[model samples]
Target chain A: GDTEPHARLPTCYPYGNLNVDELVQRLAQAGLADARVDDSKEGLVITLANDDVVIQINEFATHIISANSSLREKLRDILLECLGSF
Target chain B: LIMKNNSMKILGVNEAWGELGIVSHQLRFTERIEVEHIGPVQALTSSLHTLLSQKLGTTQVQVVSEYQLSVADSVVINIQDDNDDPGKNILLSWTHQDEALGSKLLEIIKANFKK
Candidate 1:
């Protein structure tokens, strides 16, 4: 009873929906990070540090698509570009 | 950086060790920020600095009020850390006021560093 269980995060988006490969490529293109994309159950986490802003993107597919319509569009656009890159 | 910038919020916390002699300390959020917030956008910084000053017995200063520094929106304050040089700088954008306190880590240092 002494120890608190843990934190429950209700992320609006889930990572599984994103095209993991293209998402990694898009992040690299944006200069947000540098690393090979790895798709796992743990999901992908993006961390941004622009002087003062600290943004983290962790979500499920439906929530990500619903919460940020524009970001969803960006994801689609980036995926299309990745297709052309190959 | 803005010497008059009260766009920061802060509080103080006293840390110490237990039976294991584990010492803890920092004056972050040393003061509660109760000023009616205009919203969680950008004005929170000013309210924080105002509250922090009264509690910590320190003054809030910004670089913009004086010689311009690269960081133009950070609230600067002095704390009693006789253990360290007390010359470290903390830059907060939209983070908690206690952020600056974290800069003065004293768990391990206090053992070796003499105040």
Candidate 2:
């Protein structure tokens, strides 16, 4: 059996007015392969690259968690870029 | 981390809401203080204050805003502030690879305000 590593970077975003559908499309367009969304009690969970990068959107802010630093930075940059379009 | 004016007083401490599996710490201060290299930049603080103060369509909800800064490749600190309440804030710091650095930063922050 193998163990999985985890890391979390909690940050705020304009989530109240976030358009999830558009965000996913923009992420895909940004060359981010395997961006998936799942519903949760708090909000939506956008997982990229087999759970290597996970963005958890709550009512207040978004938490970007990933085991890899580069992956987290790439996803965050794409998300920030996409946020401007929304 | 070094500070010139280290008179900011800590008023209280409480647990804050954090994502699952992530440990968070909260501290209340009498006033906000500027720190060397560790303090948030003016633009970031302004953005956080604006986001915290904005009302969401007439709802008087408790707005929580956070700003993440990567002090190092492995150490990251997420500073959280409350809407309309600057005295009460949270400093949630963690490290991806180096836990010691993250803890040291937190300790430095705590020691500065403590003095």
Candidate 3:
């Protein structure tokens, strides 16, 4: 019997007033592909989707990341690596 | 697969409004809260002062500044004080993301308004 996979709870981190394009590029550089951006009247919406992780950046300078529960540590490492570039 | 959002808005005694938005994934949480309709400026300030007095352990509520109260473990309530038109002023935000702490802060917010 297959066991249930743990849920990857999303977490949001505010990184000051960060430019959306810069973040997308950073993630893309980190091997996270399929980065998309939407600049609308409301604000900028950016999403970076891959098999291991999915990142959503809202207008409020908050980055919400969702990944597999088991990959949480790896995701953090990647995120910190990307953020450290800033 | 964790994506959920819950929001609430509370109207104060004098038409002041407070809105709370919670985005949860599994045990983690992210929230944004804003308060408008601050009743009277003096009254609201006094209320904030009193509310800020209720502390828990080493985590006492901190008055980060003249108009900001960092309550609970993670919630930060900032009051936008308007002298001439206090009622029109507001509490801009109390936001953070954490496990367990976020829900605890929500309770504190609800309790304050109930007073």
Candidate 4:
């Protein structure tokens, strides 16, 4: 029998030692809402207009988890742009 | 926290619905670990189940993906195998409050999947 194809997985990019607090502020400035550091201080959790997105960042990389592909891409672009200025 | 050789990524949404309490982690395996008669996700999941069961001394580890698993109802892990490429990474996530359990799970994963 032929095997089924794997589902599309989200991508993770490495960014050395991001200033997550500052990044959250930048995300807010970019009009993203509810952007705050998670209680664990392990990552940032942000809520989109119609979807909930969790962006987890540590010393090595950042992870953006969302079901909406388009929204995730948009958020990724905005995040990279914010990081660019830093 | 992130691992030295393992990069983390997320793929799916929070199935828990409207609950920010649900957290996820993704990690990539450096080399492809295959099992006959199963896909990458299932193969990984099986390996995780075995490892976690042995380590945790229980057989209740839930296989979430080839690279992902859940244990003791506290953490949920997802391994990434994008576009049919053998996954080299994994994601392990949990609620904000379960930091202790999360850390233990991460350690188990790191020990087994060291790059």
Candidate 5:
């Protein structure tokens, strides 16, 4: 438990007034198609192909990713491809 | 002091842990504290500061009082192996008077972080 279970992605660039739902949908479709997007107690939880990777988008619009170092970077790359630079 | 019942509502939990064993958690919440015991706003804020410092094990905590009146208080806590990224370090946020939630959270951390 002392060890962190997930790696976090940096905050995404401001979305301005873009709809979060639509944005997430587009992101999933673009690259995270294999990932499952569900609303958990942790806001939006994205389960990526790598079981270790978990992404959460909170109500405050902050995006956090958790995973091992290698997996985290890989996920970040994929996310950036979908969500753009964060 | 019998007053309105104010409890803390967990809005969200953002966590990021690295292979290096660094951990960071951002907990967002809404607070409705019964101010009867804590007295006025200023005093209540100070009390919250002390409480969080004790539970979180760091006086580095930073508090922002803007949302205290609206119940939209939040706390961003980052327990890391390194604190070089001063920019990302969480000082504090809005305050909550819910001792149970705070204690539970701390307990979870201790249970998990046993080293």
Candidate 6:
């Protein structure tokens, strides 16, 4: 069995802010034919599988558009920490 | 494969909320949930500081400036001064990926590489 861990990077836009379904569709349209998407209060969870690796993309787009512009640093830190956590 | 995500710390879930400074108390309130919660750049940086200190160990935290950097995985963590709680900052990087393989041999490097 070939079992290897894939690097999963999750980018979130909280507040039900991100259009999870639309993003999924866009990924498929953009040639990401094998992306799987899910949702939670925090945001969306996207999973992509390839021959050698599996990637998890989690994004919670900002609920408040006004706040989104300012939260970039915290968001970046949150993303990296989230990636490292798993 | 590399996966990346961004969001406020998960408020209600215990298992899912770690590394992002979501304490039980902080998680209780909706407003602090700050998922995409923003302010000026300084405010954002402050938020990041709080998150990093809570999730990771606090003493060695570093404060990051100028959000522009090629590599996004690393962060700036702030270390609090014991005297007055005025603090210093350090760059917090989860830079263990390469070091994790340090013990492996050159043959393993050539043979077992998965990427």
- Between prediction 2 and prediction 3, which has the larger TM-score? 2
Better of 1 and 3 by lDDT: 3
Which 10 residues in a row give candidate 1 chain B its minimum summed lDDT? B25-34
Better model by lDDT, 3 or 6?
3
lDDT of 6 by residue, B1-115 (tens): 2222754443423444444443221100001111232234455456555543443335434554533111223321222222322222222222223212111211222232212
lDDT of 6 at B62: 54
Q: For model 5 chain B, where is the 10-residue window of minimal lDDT?
A: B86-95
In model 6, which regions exceed 4 Å deviation? A1-16, A39-43, A51-86, B1-115
| Candidate with the greatest TM-score versus the true structure | 4
Q: Compose the digit string of candidate 5's lDDT tens values, residues B39-104.
A: 344444455455555544443346545222111123343322223322111112121223233334
lDDT of 3 by residue, B2-112 (tens): 222554445532232112132221112223233444465556655656654542432446666666666543455555544544233323232333433434444555455
Worst 10 residues of 2 chain B by lDDT: B24-33
Worst 10 residues of 3 chain A by lDDT: A1-10
State the displacement of the C-alpha of residue A38, model 3, in Å, after optimal TM-score superposition.
5.0
Tell me the docking grade of candidate 3: incorrect
CA RMSD, predictions in order? 21.4, 21.2, 18.2, 16.5, 19.1, 21.0
Distance (Å) between predicted and true CA of A20, model 1? 1.9
Which regions of candidate 4 fall more than 4 Å away from where they truly are? A1-86, B1-39, B64-68
Give candidate 1 misplaced runs (Cα > 4 Å).
A1-16, A34-42, A51-86, B1-115
Proportion of the native interface contacts kept in model 4:
0.00
| DockQ of the two-chain complex in candidate 6 | 0.02
Q: Write the per-residue lDDT of candidate 4 for residues B25-95, one digit (tens) a residue.
A: 32211112222223556676677787877766564477654556777665677666655454345666643
Judged by lDDT against the true structure, how good is candidate 5?
0.38
Residue pairs whose backbone atoms clash in candidate 3:
A9-B25, B16-B37, B17-B36
DockQ of each: 0.01, 0.01, 0.04, 0.04, 0.03, 0.02
Predicted chain B of candidate 5, TM-score versus the true chain B? 0.31
Instruction: Give the CAPRI rating of model 6.
Output: incorrect
Please give each candidate's TM-score.
0.21, 0.36, 0.35, 0.39, 0.28, 0.23
